[model samples]
Target: MVQRIDVECKNESYPIFIGELPQKLEFEGSVLVVTNSKVAGIHLRTLLQCIYAKECFVCVLEDGEEYKNIQSVQRILETAFIHKLDRQSTMIAFGGGVVGDIVGFAAGIFMRGISFVQIPTTLLAQVDASIGGKTAINNKFGKNLIGLFHQPKAVYVNPFFLGTLSHREKSSGIAEIIKMAVMFDKDFFEWLSMQNLQGSSLLEAIMRAILIKKEVVVKDELERGVRMALNYGHTFGHVIEKETQYKQYLHGEAVSMGMIMANRLAVQLGYLSVDEEFRIQKILEKNDLPIYYKIPSMESFYQSLFLDKKNENHQIRFILPHNIGRFIPCTHLSKAEIMRTLEEFCDD
Candidate 1:
């Protein structure tokens, strides 16, 4: 049977469907299908055929992280307005993380919070971004800097949709999955290590990641406490995205590199065993993820840490692993300490 998970937040409880996309959604309204050109070209017909609604509008945008800006969000909003979507109209994000975040954010504020559904096609979307209800667009400062905690009414995760994912894209999603297992479920991490990410078993891995995310988000919807664990690799990852200006690396690519940095920091802090750190490197390398980067300097990236929404009183919070599956946050580290940690792992 297809396993289902749900995130119970203060205001709402949303269900995450892991398996095939359902033939119909229980919510009824005019639906706006917001996606990118690449995904729409591949899945439009199937998505349209699956939806039982009488009215549907397909809103397509250019695909990639560079396109995930306020302009895109505005474009999506314009399309919804042009189509005359009212409060009853539901917005459906039918692609990867960027699509989901932009569409969900728009739906959240469109006429003061309308309903939205997530049909996340990428592994990254299905396991992490699409389920969290943290919808947003990037800004001049950093990735995902401006957004809202607007959860989807439902999330339909179809592994079949990932068939089109490039090796790089798959690796990006896998990094988030790795983060999930490493932070919340130790057994799941061991289970993950044993399995091959091919065929039907891929669905199982996705479900496991979704479960980890669902449980954590339910406890801390606004990322106050336990929810910070989700940023395990993201602290450095976001800086990397900003440094490169979101051009050279995929979101997951930057994250995989960020994990390498995190592991190195863990070892320096007496948290990660050397053998464990190296093993993590091996896994990421085996998956073809970049384990190192040639950053010019640590000053700008380190400076960006202060702007993190999770930071308190200018003290940047970090999520560090105690062991393979145990990660903790608010484990405050000093600026000099953080810079030294970055120096050790960050390449010249």
Candidate 2:
């Protein structure tokens, strides 16, 4: 069965189609499929069978977060230019988050923006990356430094694509689901705690997570208010990705650790109890997600934090949990307070 969620933006609204890729597809015009070599090998032909474009081009990029940079995006642009795709052409992101992000960015800038479709293969992308309109590429200074709010024409999520995901990838996606449950639905969190992530209930969890996200996005499309709450673990997760040069952890794994760090920080500020912190970590651990990291030097950590997209007025905005179903976005911490918090997590 197919599930549909509508994201209502002021200028336009689009549908997120969740289910298997249909035997038939609706392409606006000429089409280009952007993906990595690995995903192409596994699902490209199957995807091709569903498209009915007048012209089709496939550009396979090198797979990895480290490659989510301008260079990869440039390759996509070059392919579009060679194929002479115009503003009416459509670009399809046919892999995980990295592929989705870069392809989305390319479509946004190509000929000053075009339509794109998201066909997320990884669990992480299906639940978090693919649903949102945020598209970006990392810079030397930090992750997602360059991006645009380019909404996709549509998002097609086929959970069957997940069958090819490794155990690590599956666990990585679960971290995002955990983040949603912890921040918005205590009942959902309790329900997730009782289910085996590898069993039949997985898809239902993904859909529930998407439903929560749909409500948040529909309410705050530009992230000016309640939308900021969605950054629950990302404030620190993005830093971890940068400190490791995007190699040491999957995006979701770093997020798992970031959530633990955020919870610990929340506890320090008296916003969360020790018991609650432990509960969060326990759920993450149960899913085979990491709960700690040997943090880099205070200077390195500070440098990365300074570059976070969420910062403003020289203060880093932190999304800290207040309880199981709520969070507080704090940007008023003094430099000393920030330093002290970092010191607690710093490796000796």
Candidate 3:
């Protein structure tokens, strides 16, 4: 069964089609499908068969988080230029989050902004990254530090792609699904805690997560207000990704650890109870998500917090869970308080 969710933003509105890949994807103009070597080797042909554009081309880059940089974006642009794609062309992001981000950023700047569609192959991209218009490439300084808000024309989330993901990759996507529940839906959180997340249950979870994000994005497309809450674990998760140079853990794995650290802080701040914190951690652990990371340096980690995009006025902001299913963006905590939390995670 196919489920369609419409996301209406202030600047643009699009539909997210979930279930099976359409038999035919017709485009009026030329099309460029951006993907990675890993994804191309597996699912490229399936996607290629579905396209019926005036001109279709493919550009496959190296697959890995380390390659999510300006160089990759340049490669995508180079392909578009070589193919003579114009303002009327559309780009298709046919892989995972890194692929989607690169393709979206390139599409956003191509001819001063063209159009792109997301065919996110990985579970992580389908539920979280694919829905948001936030596109970016990482730099030496941080993750997603360079890019813009380039909304896709539409998003096609085919569950068939999930079957190809490794167990670890699936867990990575589950982390984001859990994030949505923890921040906005108490019943969903309770429901997730009980289920094993397979078959129909997983599909239901994906639809619910997309709907939750859609409601928030429509209200604050530019992330000027309540939308910031969506970065619940991202503030710390991005730091973990950067520190490890995006090698050690998947995006969702880093987020899993980030949530643990954030929950500890919430418990200390009296916003979440100890039992609630345990429940959150238990759910993550149940999904085989990592809940711990030894801090390399407390001082360095604290300084890195300021580099997160969510920070304002040099004060690091945190999205702390309020008793589960509710969240508040906090910026009033002192450095000493944050340092203490970091100290708790340091390995002896």
Assess each prediction's global lDDT (C-alpha) against the native: 0.84, 0.90, 0.92
Alpha-carbon TM-score of each model against the true structure: 0.96, 0.98, 0.99
Question: Residue-pair clashes per candidate, as listed?
Answer: 0, 0, 0
The better candidate by TM-score, 2 or 3, is: 3
Candidate 1 vs candidate 3: which has greater TM-score?
3
> Which lDDT tens digits does candidate 3 get at residues 191-302?
9999999788998898898899889888888888888888888888999999999999999999999999999899889999999999999999999999998999988889
Model 1, backbone clash pairs (residues 3+ apart or across chains), number: 0
Highest-lDDT candidate: 3
RMSD value for candidate 1: 1.6
Q: How far off is model 3, as Cα RMSD?
A: 0.8
Off by over 4 Å in 1: 25-27, 330-332, 345-348
Candidate 1 lowest-lDDT run of ten:
19-28
lDDT of 1 by residue, 19-112 (tens): 7776765447788899999999999888888886658888899998898999998898898899888999899999999899999999988999
**What local lDDT does model 1 show for residue 85?**
88
Full ranking by lDDT: 3, 2, 1
Summarize candidate 2's per-residue lDDT along 1-348 as a digit string, tens digits: 888888887788899988877888867689999999999999999999999989999999998999999999999999999999998899999999999999999999998999999999999999989876889999988899999888888999888999999989999999999999988998999999899976469989989988998898888877888878878888889999988999989999999988988888898888889998998899999999988887768877876787877788888899998889888888888778777777878767
